[model samples]
Target: MAENSLEKDYLEEDTQHGRYLTFSLEEEVFGIEIKYVTEIIGMQSITKVPEVPPHIKGIINLRGKIIPVIDVRLQFGKEPVDYNDRTCIIVIDIDAVSVGLIVDNVEEVLNIDDEAISPPPSNKTGFENRFMKGIGKAGGKVQLLLDCERLLKSDEMEIVEELFEEK
Candidate 1:
């Protein structure tokens, strides 16, 4: 009776919020909400935008659309690595702008329970912590869930504008 109804409600909630797309940066796992993801493409040639920040790898033409690409490794303050077969570009849309994130490789979509997500550790050191929304635990490993909107805010893009203004 009441017990059965409660179980059904829990299952429904779980189904609604139980999916994430996991990817790797360096040796750590990270995830972004799947809903924002547009597509994943293999590495491609990028045209450098002069005077832009180093993290901004450059722009890529996708089906007649030019999208800026960011090397997540550089964004995270790691030494840049050469693009290899496993490298990929993950297209995502934030605030109506489509951008591509260059990642080492994408793992797979995971169903992580909402209850398993914990707030970012207060003591974490480095710039990486500022980009993390929370930490999700699954299969005994931690996935640093990113706050995409914060990570891709206009403040950082202002640097790009400044570069163009100087030219």
Candidate 2:
């Protein structure tokens, strides 16, 4: 039984090894490891929370489970735009905590090999690339691959985790 479980785990890892779920934010595109994604939902009514950061849009009741949603544009310091038909919420699980990322629109999944990935630029120009894990080259285009663990800082994660515990 243990051997079978091990084999299944290996197979799952192999299939998701280089798979990425791409999404667009304005003109730039970003990718997240497909393994972390739980589901992609359309824009829904969000209940605003007070005293939270501006980037945090608020929480949503997803089938009785309250999920905190964050605006990717606001999180990246970009100007906010009205949510439209194209808006999507990508629900992801990081470190056992689930959070929803509000993005402009979700693109198709792509398989980017390790050889096609390049490290992010140095953080010497006062530019922030902390959320980026690497840059993926796919089909003649560059995709900024996000490190979901780093998407929310430790402090922020704690706060989000608390929300999960509260309910």
Candidate 3:
């Protein structure tokens, strides 16, 4: 039974590898590793927290668990827009931390092979490459691959950790 369980876990990980959950933030599209995604939900009433960055929208009580949400558009330095029916919150778990990413809308799960990914452009171009894992080209389109672990700065991560502890 233990061997079976291990095999199952390995198979699941193998299947999820190289797959990405694609979402949009305006005209630009982004992709995050599918393995980190927990769930996708419609916009919910967010209880705002204080003293944090503006990009950190707030927290939402998700079936009893409180998850901090970040507005991807604001985080990427884009103008804020009204949330419509198409807006979605993508819940993801990174390094045991669960958080929600508010995006314009989710596109689809794409299987992008490693060969289809390329390194992001140099930061000298005034582009923030730290938040990006790579650039994925597939299906005749390009998607900015996000580095989930680097999405939050170190100090912001402390705030998120504290929020989880307090709630």
List, residue by residue over 62-143, the lDDT tens digit for candidate 2: 9998999999999999999999999999999998878999999999999999999999988987779999999999988999
Q: What are the candidates' C-alpha RMSDs? A: 5.6, 1.8, 2.1
Ranking of predictions according to TM-score: 2, 3, 1
Q: What is the C-alpha lDDT of each candidate?
A: 0.83, 0.93, 0.95
In candidate 3, stretches whose alpha carbon ends up further than 4 angstroms from where it belongs are 1-9
lDDT of 2: 0.93
Residue 90 CA error for candidate 1 (Å)? Answer: 0.4
Instruction: Please provide TM-scores, in order, for all candidate models, with all chains considered together.
Output: 0.82, 0.94, 0.92
Number of clashing pairs per prediction, in order? 0, 0, 0
Better of 1 and 2 by lDDT: 2
Model 1 Cα RMSD, 1 decimal: 5.6
* Candidate 3 global CA lDDT score: 0.95
Q: Once superposed on the true structure, which residue ranges of model 2 sit more than 4 Å away at CA?
A: 1-8
Q: Please, what are the lDDT tens digits per residue for candidate 3 over residues 1-167?
A: 99999999999779988999999988999999999999999999999999999999999999999899999999999999999999999999988999999999999999999999999999889986899999999989999999999998899899889997853
Return the clash pairs for model 1, or none: none
TM-score of predicted model 1?
A: 0.82
Task: Kindly give the stretch of ten consecutive residues in candidate 3 with the minimal lDDT sum.
Answer: 158-167
Ranked by lDDT, top first:
3, 2, 1
